[model samples]
Target: MSTLLKPEAVNRPSMAAQAAESVVIVMAGADQLPVRRKGGAKPVSVDLLAALVEAALPDGFGGVSRIGFETAWEAMAPETRRALTDDLTCYLGWSASEKRQAFPADPEDLVRYLRWLEQGRGFRPATLTRRIASISRIHRMLSLSSRDTLPTRAAMVADALKAARRRRGSQQRQAAGVRLGPMMNPQDEVEGVTLAMLFSVCTSDLQGLRDGALLAVAFESGLRVSELAAIHIRDVDPQADGRGILTIGKTKTDQEGEGRYAWLSVDTMRRIGAWLEASGLEDGPLFRRVGVDRRQGRPARAPQDYFSIPGHTRHWQERLQGRPAEPPLARYAIGEGPLTRQGIGVIYKRLVRAVIDEGMVELEPGREGDLVRAISTHSMRVGLTQDLFASGEDGAGVCQAIGWRSVSTALRYVRKQSVKGGAVSRVMDGLRR
Candidate 1:
C-alpha cells in the first residue's frame, strides 16, 4: 500500500500532487495523451478507461469519446476511482455470465440484475444502491460527453429500485456499539460489551497496549476507521486537566481541510503514552502494525536409541546434553507505516474475542459469533453516538460532536433507543407511577 498522505503535506510533492502537474483537457483521440514529468505520477490508463467506456456503450453504438472518459477519470477522487472501477468490472462480468449487454442497460435487464443481486446473490439494499449509483454516474458521464439519453434514469429502473426498497427495507444494518458502560441504556437493562470491559482485558503486552490506546482514542473521538488510522503523533494536544484534545485535520464530511477537535480522557491519554513509550515511536502515525514472533518451548526428552524420529533427533540430543529446554518467547516488531483501516477492524475483533475470553463481557452459548460479526471498524463511532443519545444529548449535539453534516444522519444511529425517551414513554411513566 502507498504511504498515507499527511493531511497538511501539500508542499511535499506526492503522487496526487504530481498527477495534477500533467492534466490538460483536449479533443477526443488527440495525437498525444497528457504527459507527466519524467518521474511524476501517471493518470489512470486510457486502456482501462476505454474498456469502461466500451462496456457502457450499447450494441452498434459508441459514446463517451476518449477525451470525455479521460476528463471523467481525472475528475474522480482516488477512492471513487477505485470503487467505480470495481463496480463497473463486477457489473460487466455479471452481464457477460448472464449473456446480456451491460452498457446502455435495458430497464427489463436491469430489473433482472437487481433481482439476481437481492434474491440470488443475497446483497443488501445499501450495496444495490451503490451499484445503481455507479451505473447512473457512468451514464451521466456518457450523456454529458455525447448527448446520449440516460438509461438508468428510465422509469422501469426507478420502479425496480422502489420494489427492492419495499422488499428489503432501506434501513442499513448498523455495526453494534461499544459503549463506555455495560448497559448502553440503563432504563432498558440491555447489557453488552463495553470499552471498560475491553480495557479490563487489555494486558501489558505490546499488542494489548496498542489495542487499548486505539479503542480508547476511537471511542472518545468517534472517529471513522480511516481518520483513526491517520492519526499522527503531532495531532494530540495535552490539556492542563490531564485530558487531551485531538485534532482531526480531515474527515469524510470535512473535505475542505478545516479541522475539528475531540476530547480524550486522561485514561485514553495514559494508554496512548504507554503505547508510544513501549513502541519507542518518536513521530509519524500513532497506530501501526505490530508483528509478533512466538517461539514455542519443547519438553526435554531422553536421547533416542533404537528408533529415531527424523526431526526429533536434534531435540533428543539437546536433552541428553542437559541443556534447559527453550522457554516460549514472544517479541513484537513495530511497523513504520500507519495501520490500514482493515487492520484496525481486525484489531477490534481480536480484542472483542480477548474480552470474551477474559470473561469481562459474557454472552449466551452459541451467540459469540453473532456478537463478533456485528462489531466492525464503525462500532466505536456507532457506540459513541448511542452513548451520547442515552445520556440526553440531542441530535444536533451528536452531529457537531461526530462532525456529521446532518442531524438525520446522527439520529439514524439511535433510532431504536430514541423511542424509550420519547414523549409517550415519559407520559406513560408519569401516569403509571
Candidate 2:
C-alpha cells in the first residue's frame, strides 16, 4: 500500500498560511480576474471542491481529521484538483453500485473493478492506469486522516494490473493533425485538411469571422483548447511588421505563470482584427460565441380567393390587409462567455465538412468518416509540431515554441516527417536508384 506522507514533511506551504491565503483569494474573487497570479490562476472554487467531496465521499467533512485533506487541496494546481475530483467521483459511483466500501478498498475488489473497467467498459490502458492512480491517491489521503489502508498497493492488485496491461498493450492513439502546407513551401499541395483550406470556407459573417480568427490563432500559437479559450483581447498586441505577439499569461505547461509569448503571422493578425471589428469586442475572451438568429421574410401579400375555405380565406385576407413583405434577415448576437473547448472542436469539424462539401478538399473513397473522427482539439497542436519538424526545426525548438516543457511530449507528434528525413532515409535517398 502506498504510504501517505505528512503534508509538513514535504516542501509544501504551511497549513496555516495556505488556509489564510485561500480564504483571502476566495473572498477577493481572485479567480474571476482576467489577469492571473505568477503561476496560473486558481480557478477552482472551494465550494465546488467541498460539494464534490460531500457527494462522493461516504462521510462528508464533518470530522476534524479530514481537515488536512482540505488544507492539502489548497496547495494543488487547479487542473490536478479538477482531474482528481472527477476520477474520484467516477470510482466512488461505481463502488457504491457494487456495494463496496471505497475508503479502504479490498484487493480482490480492486482487481474486479479493474477487469470491469477494461473488459466491460472497454477502457484503454491509459485510462485504466489513471483510474488506478486516482484510487491510490484517494486511499493515501484517507490513510493520512482515517484508518484506511492502500489496497491499490496490494501485490495481487499490482499483479492483476500488470496482467491486464500485458493483455491490452499500452499504445495511445494520437489525434490526427490539421496541418498547414509544408513550412518551407507554403504553397505546396497538402492532401488532408490544411489550415488554408479551413480559412477558405470561412465566410464574412460574424460566425465565420470568429471561427477564422480562432483557427488562425490556435494554429499559430499551438495553444491547447483551454489556453485558446482563455485568450483575452488585452493580451494580444500588434507589431510593427503587421504581425502580432500574444502574451500567454499561463499555459498548461507553464502553470506557474512564468508567461510566454507566441508569434502571430500577419495573416492571422488580419483575421483577428476582422473578427474583433465585426464583433465590436474590445476586451474579455477573444473568441466568444456568436448566436445566429435567422428570420425568413414573407413574400408580397396574395389576393384572397372568395371560394377558399373559411380559415384560409381569413389568413389571406389578413395578409392582404396592408401587411408588407419582410426581407430575410440574419442577426448575430455575441455572447459574453468564451467558446468552450467542445465548441472549438465543433467549429473545426463544421469547417472541415464545409470545405469538403465545397470541393476545396477531397477524401479517399470510404475514408471520409475516418478523417472526421481523427480531427480533434489537439489536431492544431499536432499540426504545429509536425510542421516545425518538417521545416527542419529540432525537437527542442519545437518544444519551446509550442510551450512544451518536455522534449518527449513534443516527440509524439514528429513521426512521418521526422522518419522521412532521418539518417537512414538520407543515406539511401542520396544514392539514386
Candidate 3:
C-alpha cells in the first residue's frame, strides 16, 4: 500500500509548476505597447473639424451644420458654389445669435422651431423667410437633390408663413395709414415750428443738444432714428459747401448692403454743426450719455469720453489732458454707432413724449386725426416719403434717397392722396355726360 501511494504522487507539484511557467512565458510573448511621440501633438479628426465649423456659425439653430451641408451639396454644382459662398458669408456676418445647441430632428420640429423664432424672437417677416430658406437649403443639401420638395411636414408651415406675411402686409398698410394720419393740418403746418420750439425749451445741456440735433435731422432730412443714430463723423462732410452728404450705410430695407448718399439740408447741417461744436465731438460715437457731476452738469468734454469702456477710461483721461496715449484720439466725440430696433422705438417714444409734454403736436385721445397720435421711429421715414411724394418727387428719386433696392418698397412709402366724397362716382357721372 505504501509503494502504490508513493508512485501515484510522483512529480505532481513539479508538473503544476511547469504548467504555470509555460503560461507566464506565453503571456510575455504578446504584442508590445506602442510608444508615444516626444513632442508632436495629436491631430484633430475630420469629423471634429466638421463639428468645429458647425460650432463657429453665429446664427442660432445649427447654422454652421446647415452651411456645411449647403457647401457639400454645392460642390456637386460648380455654377452655384460662388453664389452660395457669398450668401453664407453675408448670413454669418449679419446673424446676431450663436449657433443653437441642437438641430430639429423632424420637419414638424423645424416648423415649430420657426414659429418659436417668430413669436419669441419677433423675427421680421423678411428674417423669418430667410431662416426658413436656410432650413430648406439644409434639407435639400441633406437629401443630395434640389428636386426634392421642401420637407413635406413643412407644407403647413409654409402656408402659415405665407399667411403670416399677408397679415403682416395688411398690418403694415394699417400702420402706414396711422403713420400718415391725415396731412399736417392745413393750418397746423405751424406745428413743426412748435415742435422745434419744444425741443429748444427742453434744456441746453448735452441731452438738449442731442434732442435738438435729433429733431432737427429727423424733421429736416426725414431720417428714421436708425439713420440718425448711425450717422458717423466721417459720414458727414461739414465742408461740403453748406450741404453735407449723408452716406446711409443701412436702412430698414437696405440692411447695410449698398450705402446711399443723400444730401443734407442747410438747417440740418447747421444743427449738426452746432451739436458737434457744442459737444466738442471730432470722432467716434456721435451721441453718448452726458455725464453729470455733482456740481458741473453735462460738461462739454469730448464726446469720445462718453462712449469709452471702463478699461479705456484711464487712457481716455490721459488723452483728454493732451498727453500721449495708446491709440491716439481715442477720446474724441463719436456718435452712437448703430441704433437697435428697440432703441429706435424707445427714442421715438421719448421724442413723442417730449413733443406731447410741450403741447407742440396735439395727440388727442381716441381721435385718429391728421395729428400724429403715437409716432414711431419709422414714422420719420414714412412721413418724409409722403412729403416728398406730395411735393411731386417720383418713386425712383425717393428710392435713390432712401436706399431702397426695389421700386415696390418705395411705393409702400408713397401713399395716394385720399380724395373726398366718391370722386370715382363723380368721374363716372362726367363720363355719362
Candidate 4:
C-alpha cells in the first residue's frame, strides 16, 4: 500500500533551501559528524542528517509531490544528503562524471531513452523537445562555471527540434487534404434517417426516449458533441407548440467568457419531454443510464443499490454492477457519466457502432481505394451542416444556428454537396444568359 505524507511533518528545516549545500558533502561519501552551536540551545539535527540519504532516491514526476519530497528529506541521513548534493553539483558541471566515470559510455543509450519516451510515455514530438530543453537548462544551471562547453547536449537538442518540426509539418499537410474523409463521406447526401428515421429510432422507454431526444436535438439544432453534452435540463425551455429554446453555456470556438442561447424546432421539445417523463428524472443531469440486468435481458424495476444521478456520483464504477452481473453487462456500466468527456466518447462510439451494425446506415469506404469502414458520432454534426448549406441557408444563418464563433470553423463542415449544387446553379444561369 502507498503511504500519504503530510507537509507539516518536516517544518523544522526547509529541505529545498539545503539541497544545494547538502549535495557537496554527500558525494564525497564521508561519515557525518555532529556540530555544537555557540551559546544556543542545541536542536536535534538527526532529521537534517537523514535528508542526505533521501537525496539519492530515484527522481520521477510521479513521486515528486511537495509532501513526498519533504518526507523523503526528513528520512535521510545528513552525510548522505551532503554527498548527494556534491555529486549532483559535480554531475551538473560534467566534471565529477569525468573523474568518477558515472556517465553512460554508449551513445545508443540516449537514442533508446528517446524511443522509450516516445513509445512508452506517449510524448508528442513537441513534448519530447520540451523535455530535452528542460534537461539542457538543468545542465546549464548546475555547471560550476558559465564557460563550460556542453556542445554535445546542445547539438542533440537542436537535431531533435528540427526532426519534430518536420514531422509536425508533414502531419498538418496530410491532415489538410482529407482528414474527415476516412471517418465520413462529405459528398454523400443525407440519406439514412431524414426526420422519419428520427421517429423510428424513438421508443417509449426512458433510455430510448433520451436517445430519441438527443437525436432530435442533433438533427434540428445541429449541435456539436461538446455543445450537446454541456446542455442542462433547465437550459431547455419546452413550449406548448412542441418547440423549445436552448441556452448554450459555452461552445468550442467561443471561450469568450459568456454563454449563448438559441431557439430550436417543435420536434426537439416533444422528444425531450418524452424522455424526461419516462426516465423519472425531475432535475439534474439531462441524460442518465438505466439499471440493466444482463442475465434476464431487462431493466431493474426498482432503483438498484448503485443507481445514482450524474454529478453526484464521483466515478462510473459505482453505477456498473449488482451482486450478480455478467462481464459484458458490467463493461457497459464502467465510467459512464452525464456530460463528461469519457461519457461523450463512449456514447458516440456506441451510437455509431450500433447504427453501423444494425444496417440503419451505410457509410462509404475511407479514401479512394482503401476498404476500411469508418463512422463516428461527429459525422452527425458534419452531415447536418452539409445538409443545411446545400439547402441554401445563408452563412450567417448557419453560423448563428450552429453557435459557431467564427464563420471559417462552420465553413469547414460545408461539404462538396453544397459546392457542387452552387456550381450546377451557376452553369444553369449561364445557359439562360
For model 1, the local distance difference test gives 0.74
lDDT of each: 0.74, 0.73, 0.49, 0.47
lDDT digits (tens) for residues 1-433 of candidate 4: 1111111211122355333222111111112222212442223343432343234223441322345445544544443334444433333333233332212212233344445566665556755555454333333333312434543264554575566566553221111111212223333455443344434544433345566667666556666665776676777876555457777775655555287766776555666666655444555657544332233223334333554546567644535543333222211121123543334444444554454455555647443112112334454566556666666787788788776666776676654455656677568866976
- Which 10 successive residues of model 2 have the least lDDT summed? 1-10
Predicted candidate 3 versus true structure: per-residue lDDT over 1-433, tens digit per residue:
0100111211122554433332110111112312223542233333443454364433654344455654565343322333344333333433324333223324565556566666776765666666666555544544523544555335777776776687565334222311323344342122232344435454544445565556556654556555666677677765434656666675555543476666766666666666666566667645443322222122233334544446646566644554322221111122234434344555555555565566655555754333334455566666666655555577788767765567787666543442211357447756876
lDDT of 1 by residue, 1-433 (tens): 1222221311123566434333221111211322212642234464675676686566667555777778877666555776677777778877889988777677788778888899988988888878888877877666633424566666887788888889989999988888887554556444578888777777656677788889889999999887998899888877776678889986777666798999998777777877776677767989887766566655555554544456556565554455445545555666667877767887888888987777766778998999999999998898888888888888888989988779998888878888888888888987987
RMSD of every candidate to native, in Å, equals 12.6, 14.3, 30.1, 22.3
TM-score of 3: 0.53
The true-versus-predicted C-alpha distance at residue 421 of model 2, in Å, is 1.0
True lDDT of residue 42, candidate 1: 32
**Model 2: residues with Cα > 4 Å off, grouped in runs:** 1-67, 76-78, 143-150, 183-191, 301-312, 315-323
The alpha-carbon lDDT assigned to residue 407 of candidate 3 equals 73
What is the lDDT ranking, best to worst?
Answer: 1, 2, 3, 4
Candidate 3 residue spans exceeding 4 A from truth: 1-105, 110-134, 137-148, 152-154, 162-169, 173-202, 218-227, 239-241, 249-258, 293-344, 364-374, 416-433
Residue 228 CA error for candidate 1 (Å)? Answer: 1.1
What TM-score would each prediction reach against the true structure?
Answer: 0.78, 0.80, 0.53, 0.47
Q: Give the per-residue lDDT of model 2 (tens digit) for 240-318.
A: 7677888998666676789999999877777787777656677788987666656666776665555553754546656
